[model samples]
Structures are given as C-alpha cells and as structure tokens.
Target: MTTLYGYYRSSAVYRVRIALNLKGLAYDQAPVNLVKGEQRSEANLARNPQGLVPVLESDEGTPLSQSMAICEYLDERYPEPPLLPADAEGRARVRALAQLVACEIHPLNNLRVLKYLVRELEVDEDAKLAWYRHWIIEGFDALETLLKRELGTGDFCHGDTPTLADICLVPQVFNAERFECNLSAFPTLRRIVDNCNALEPFQKAAPSEQPDAG
Candidate 1:
C-alpha cells in the first residue's frame, strides 16, 4: 500500500491528502509530528532531505516529494477524474491558480517561516500573527479578483468539477481561517471552498479527520 508521511495540519500535506482522496486512492498515514520536530529525524531526512512533512511513498516504493508534484503524479497515474483540464490553455489557467496559493501565499505563512520568526528572530506572538494575516490578505485579494472575474471559473476554481487549483485553495483557506484572518472580502474564494468541503473527498481529507489530528 502507498503511505504518506505528513503532519495533520501542514497545508502541503493537506493538499496531498485531498488529491489522493479525490483520485479514490487508499493510502496509509505515517504521521511526522511537526510540533515535536519529528520531521527532522534521520528516518524522515532519509525520505526527504528538506525535512518537510508529506513524503509520499508510492505503491512501487518510489518516494515523492512536494505537494504539487505528488498531486500531478496521482492525476497522471489515475486519470479517471482528471485534476487538470483537457485543453492546454485551461491547464495553464488551473496551474496558475494553484501556484498563486501554493507558491505565493503558502510559502510566506508556512510553519517553518513562522517558527523562524518566533524562535530565531524573537518575534512576539502578536507580530507573528500579524505577519501571517498580512500575506494571507494580500494573496487572497489577488486570488479573489481572478476567480470572480475569470470566465473560466465555475463551481470550482477552474470549472464545475474540482481541479488542482481547488486542491491548493482549500488548504490555504483552512490555514487562513485557523489564524483568524478576515476573509469577508473574498466571497468568491469562500464560495469555492464551501463547494469543495461539501464533497466527501474534501471532507475525508480535512485536517481534523487525520489520524494524528490530536
């Protein structure tokens, strides 16, 4: 069986879980407790030198790193309900949307960055939270405009069905809400997230549903 090495709350890991569930793939979870610094253990380091949660060991025993890459791998390997669009243009748009969050928004607010602020820089809790919310608002502002104005957007980020964009969006939104970031301005984003959470795939992949959620 395939196994996922990840933390329950890591957005990157969350994204992978959603993709796996969407693809109807059954996998085992090998929790890497980020809070306890288990990701840095020699075992995990052997899996991924970057020491990040979510190193997916494929059924063939091939280890995969990076959430986007893992999701694309699953999409390619199991093409039933495609995660990307059929057309090249549509695929480009979906990738752009996915990267807007995965590359831009998430990197700034990632747990490691936040830890650096508090542990290394001695940033207070309030300031750390301020830093988190700032990037979230900035990114969400741009994302909302694109989603609302783009004719490509339907019930999900790119179309009526979920895509890579939706996979990235939902996890980032979950992080934003966890930090109490004001999301009233991003109605379009919220609507898409609500639509996503209504599905069983998204529900099963939620952070709370993970075995190590406690």
Candidate 2:
C-alpha cells in the first residue's frame, strides 16, 4: 500500500493529502513528529535527505520527496481528474500560481525557518509572528491582484475546477490563519479558498481531520 510520512499540521503534507484525496487514492499515514525532531532521524533521512515531512512511499516502494513534485507525480500517474489544465498555456499559468505560494511564500515561513528565527536568531514570539504576517501579506497581496484581474479566474484559482494552484493555496491560507495573519485584504483569495474547502477532497484532507493531528 502507498504510505505518507508526514506531520498532521504540516502544510506541505497537507498539500499531498489533498492531492491524494482528490485522486481518490487510499494511503496510510506514518506520522513524523516535527516538534520532536523526528524528521531528522535516520529512517526519515533515508527517505528524504532534506529532513522534510511528506515523503511519499509509492506502491512500488519508491520514496518521493518535495510536495510539488509528489503532487505532479500523482497527477501524471492518475490522470482521471487532471490537476493541471490540458492546454500548454493553461498549464503554465496554473504552475505559476502554484509556485507563487509554494516557492515564494512558504519557504520563508515554514517550520525550519521559524525555528531558526526563534532558536538561533533569538527572535521573540511577537517579532516572529510579525515576520510571519509580513511575508504572508506581501505574498497574498500579489496573489489577490493576479486572481482578481486575470480573466482565467473562475470558481478556483485557474478555472472552474480546482487545480494545482488551489491545492497549494489552501494549505498556505491555513497556515496564515494559524499565525493570525490579517486576510481582510484578500477577498478574492478567501472566496476561492472557500469554494475549495467546500469540496469533500479538501475537507477530508484537512489537518484537524488527520490521524496525527494534535
């Protein structure tokens, strides 16, 4: 059986869960407690050298790392409900939107970076939260503008159906809310996220619903 090694609250892992759920694929979860530093253990490092949550063990027993790569792999292997658009231009747009969140916003705010800020840089809780909110607002500002003005916008980020963009967007939004980031400025983003959350795929993949959720 396919298995996912990840923490319950990890947004990266959350992304994979949504993709797997959308594909209607059944998988077992192997929780690696990030707070306990279990991701850096020998077992997890063998699966993913980066010490990251969300190492997906394929049915063939091949381990895959990186959330976006794993998501694309699932889309390619199970093409029933495509996560990307059929057209070349549409695919490019969807990837760009997905990257805007995954590459730009998430990197600066992920657990490792936040841990480094507090543990190494001696950042206080207030300052750490300020840093988190600042980047979220900065990234969401650009995302909101693009989604609002882009003619391709539909019920989801790219079109009427959920795509890779929405898959990436929802987890980031979840983290932003957890950090208490003000999202009042991004109504378009909220509207699209609301649509995504209403679906069973997204709902089933929610962090709170995970077996390892604390």
Candidate 3:
C-alpha cells in the first residue's frame, strides 16, 4: 500500500493528502510530529533529505518528496481525473496559479521559517506573527488581483472542475485562516476555497480529519 509520512497541520502535507484523495488513491498515513522535531529524525531524513513531512512511498515502494513534484507525479501516473489542463496554454496558466501560492506565499510562512524567526533570530511572538501576516496579506493581495482579473477562473481555479491550482490554493488558505490573517480582501480566493472545501476529497483531507490532528 502507499504510505504518506506527514504532519497533520503541515500545509504541504495537506496538499498531498488532497491530491491523493482527489485521485481516489488509498494510502496509509505515517504521522511525523513536526512540533516534536520528528521531521529531523534519521528515518525522516532518509526518506527526505530535506527533513520534510509528506514523503509519499508509492505502492511499488518508490519514495517521492516535495509536494508539487509528488502532485505532478500523481497526475501523470493516474490520468483519469486530470489535475492539469489538456492544452499547453491552460497547463501553463494552471501551473502559474499553483506556483503563485506554493512558491510566492507558502515558503515564507511555513513552520520551519516561523521557527527560524523565533529561535534563530530571537524574534518575539508578536513580531513573528506580524511577519506571518505581512507575507500572507501581500501574497493574497496579488492572488486576489490575478484571480479576479483572469478570465480562466470558474468554480475552481482553472475551470469548473478542480485543478492543480485549487489543490494548492485550498491548503494555503487553510494556513492563512489558522494564522488569523485578515481575509476580507480576497473574496475570490474565499469563494474558490469554499468550492474546494465542499468536495468530499478536500474535506476528508483536512488537517482536523487526519489521525495525528490532536
């Protein structure tokens, strides 16, 4: 069986969970408690040299790391419900949208970065939170502008069906909400996230539903 090594609330792991669920692929969860520094354990380092959660070992025992790469691998391997678009132009657009969140927003606010701000830089809690909200607001502002201006957006990020963009968007939105980042500015993002959360695959993949949530 496929196994996913993940932390319950890690947005990157949550993204993979959503992708796997959407693909209708059954997988076992191997919880890595990031808060307890389990991600740096020898086992996890062997699975992912970067010491990250969400190392997906395929049924054939092929271990894959990095959420975007894993998601694209799944899309190619299981081409039924295509996560990307058929056309080259559409595919590029979808990938751009997904990257806007995954690259532009998520990196600065992930657990490791936050920890670095606190432990390494000696930033107080309030400053760390300010740093978090600052980046979220900046990224969401750009995302909202893009989503609103783009003609490709439908119920989801690409078309009526959920695509790779939606898969990435939902998890980032979850993190934004968790940080209490003011989301009143991004109605388009909110609507897209609502559409995504309504789906069974996305709901099942939520952090709260994970075995290690508590």
Error of model 2, residue 34, in angstroms? 0.4
lDDT string for model 2 (1-214, tens) is 6999999999999999999999999999999999999999999999999999899987689999999999999999999799999999999999999999999999999889999999999999999999999888999999999999999899999889999999999999999999888899999999999999999999999999999989
Instruction: Give the per-residue lDDT of model 1 (tens digit) for 1-214.
Output: 7999999999999999999999999999999999999999999999999999789987589889999999999998899799999999999999999999998899998778999999999999999999999998999999999999999999999989999999999999999999899999999999999999999999999999999999
Candidate 1 at residue 128, lDDT? 94
| Clash count, candidate 2 | 0
**Superior candidate under TM-score, 2 versus 3:** 2
Instruction: State the lDDT of candidate 3 residue by residue for 2-58, as single tens digits.
Output: 999998999999999999999999999999999999999999999998998789986
In angstroms, the error of model 1 at 40 is 0.2
> Which is the winner by lDDT between candidate 2 and candidate 3?
2
Higher-TM-score candidate among 1 and 3? 1
Score residue 14 of candidate 1 by CA lDDT: 96
lDDT score at residue 111, model 1, on the 0-100 scale:
78
Candidate 2 accuracy as TM-score:
0.98
Q: What is the TM-score of each candidate against the true structure?
A: 0.98, 0.98, 0.98
| List of clashing residue pairs for candidate 3 | none
